[model samples]
Target: MSRVLLLGGTGDALRIARSLRAEHVYSLAGLGRTPVDLACGVRVGGFGGAQGLVRYLADEAIALLVDATHPYAARISANARAASSDARVPYWALRRPAWEPQADDDWRFVDAWPHVVAALAPFRRPLFTLGREPLAHLDAIPAHQHWTVRCLDAHPGNERARIIDARGPFTLDGERALFDAGGYDVVVSKNSGGAATEAKLQVARERRLPVVMLRRPALPAADREFGDVAGVIDALRAQPFPIVR
Candidate 1:
């Protein structure tokens, strides 16, 4: 039987990992929590780069490489595509669709950090949901601005910023309360399309606050692409190898 290798970090990836058998492997970048309850074997940390990944695929006999990482994780996706090609293995990706602006949403799309900073100049209080990226800029916060940054891990923020460590699948009411308390004039977020953290967008729309959205990067094409976990699971089940959970 052919063995599968799943690269994952996002919630969608975890869902896919849960459906895998013990013969399959679930790989993580070691940034967040590692699950001990998974039936499939778990491997943490990186494979150096594309060349290293090619070696790993060959050494481990990975027949299928599934990239279920976050949508913004462009480098890893690119490496997976390259490594799969080099190793002559099938590559699959779960490319989550980005969130679209609704009728009442005031969204400003930015391609880089400098652009995001420029767009945020006028706002006194801004809520940031771009993960750990905002933590590095805490010292650079403008004199008149106070930032509320949310990410996966807790950190000690400077006087101009406050860090809240939390995960999502957040509720609408919870987001409404947070927005009300923060009194945020603007929201800084990545266009990571999923139900997990999408409540913030709806709250922003309801409160008439503008959102500065980080643009999605161009990822390398995979042999097959899926938009959701169910589709990926179905595809895996259809593979020649037995993938029963």
Candidate 2:
């Protein structure tokens, strides 16, 4: 049977994997402390790099490559592009639409975490939802202000920053309650987009909170890019069967 390699990270990856008719393998970088519920056979961790990924695709006879990772996961997306070209497999990127600023929103877009830090200097009692990777920058924040950081898990044991161990599809009411109760002065997050984590933005807007939004990294364009799961399904269905050489 032809196998499509579904690069899994985002919720869309799991949805696409579940929708596939052909044999497929769901691949995760294994960044999460616990495994997410996946729809098909799974592979965890990296394929080393582009070269390693190419070898895996060739060796496993991956016919189609679907990248459905977080918008900020640039390295893996680049690797997938290179590996798919080397392996002669069709590649598609499942990118969700980015959030646009509304009339009431106070958004400051920056390129990276350092820029976020520099922009954040004037704000007090800031809340960061940029996930754990960006947590390293927390040490540089002024000691006078107490910061709140939210993550999927509670592993870091960070006493310096107040940690909220929560997962999302968070609601506007929930976000408002959290912010109101925490008495946050400002908000920081990546431009991750999609519905799952967007409530914080809406709440920020309603509360007149200044949002320090990190612009997404420029990812290599795939042979095709899809905005939704149905588009991805159509793309996969259009591909030829996997070949075992």
Candidate 3:
């Protein structure tokens, strides 16, 4: 009789929920738009903080916790670690394999967001995908620069970018078509760290466009690392969860 509070926003997390559906009662916690075909119960947004999560663990009797959030979401990872430890509960972080720069990939992996904004100085015909909220980061860029930016919202923000609002896990065909059609010379995106959003990178590779990519932030120490939901299930079966995800 185990109950778990799951921290997820990745495809793998949903898969883990499906894999363990027959055996465990799970409560999924995530951000952004809720998925339509998820297989478990859910909560959304920050868990108040470490103390809030601790309270939740005690009140809900969440015997275990699994984080499947985006790898770049460092804040949640830290919160999960501190909360789980303070509550004396077990936890795990499900992370996908990070994309590396291949010979074909002419990516210049920028270590920070500000650097990506600054790259605009030397480049043009740029395609951007820093997600929805970081649009302001582009404000510091020169106004004369023309950019092709994408988002999930229709009216993202007023900026120099020609905003393309669409959804993720985009097809390579569409991504490539957009880049080619737009005559993009450079790609600037975050290491958001998930396949759904990584499609853009693949598209960039196909076009051989130069990239100004952001690196992923750190996660708190976890008991184990899972590349997929199947790995998470296997770990839960084998031993206690990790310290962070």
What does candidate 2's lDDT look like per residue over 1-245, in tens digits?
A: 66888888777777776665435788888876424454467788889999999999988878788899989899999999999998898898988888999988899999977788799889778888988865665566587677898987775535567878888789888998998888988899988888889999988888899999899889999988988878887766666763211
Model 2 misplaced stretches (Cα beyond 4 Å): 33-39, 157-159, 238-245
Where does candidate 3 clash, by residue pair? Answer: 93-245, 222-243, 222-244, 223-242, 223-243
Q: Write the residue-wise lDDT of candidate 3 on 184-233 in tens digits.
A: 88888876665677777887777777888788887787876777766677
TM-score of 2: 0.92
TM-score-wise, the better of 2 and 3 is 2
TM-score of every model?
0.99, 0.92, 0.84
Worst 10 residues of 2 by lDDT: 236-245
lDDT of 1 at 188: 97
Candidate order by lDDT, decreasing, is: 1, 2, 3
Top model number, TM-score: 1
Cα lDDT, all candidates: 0.94, 0.82, 0.71
Model 2 RMSD, rounded to 1 decimal: 2.9
Measured on C-alpha atoms, candidate 3 has an lDDT of 0.71
By summed lDDT, the worst window of 10 consecutive residues in model 3 runs over 22-31
> Which pairs in model 1 have colliding backbones?
none
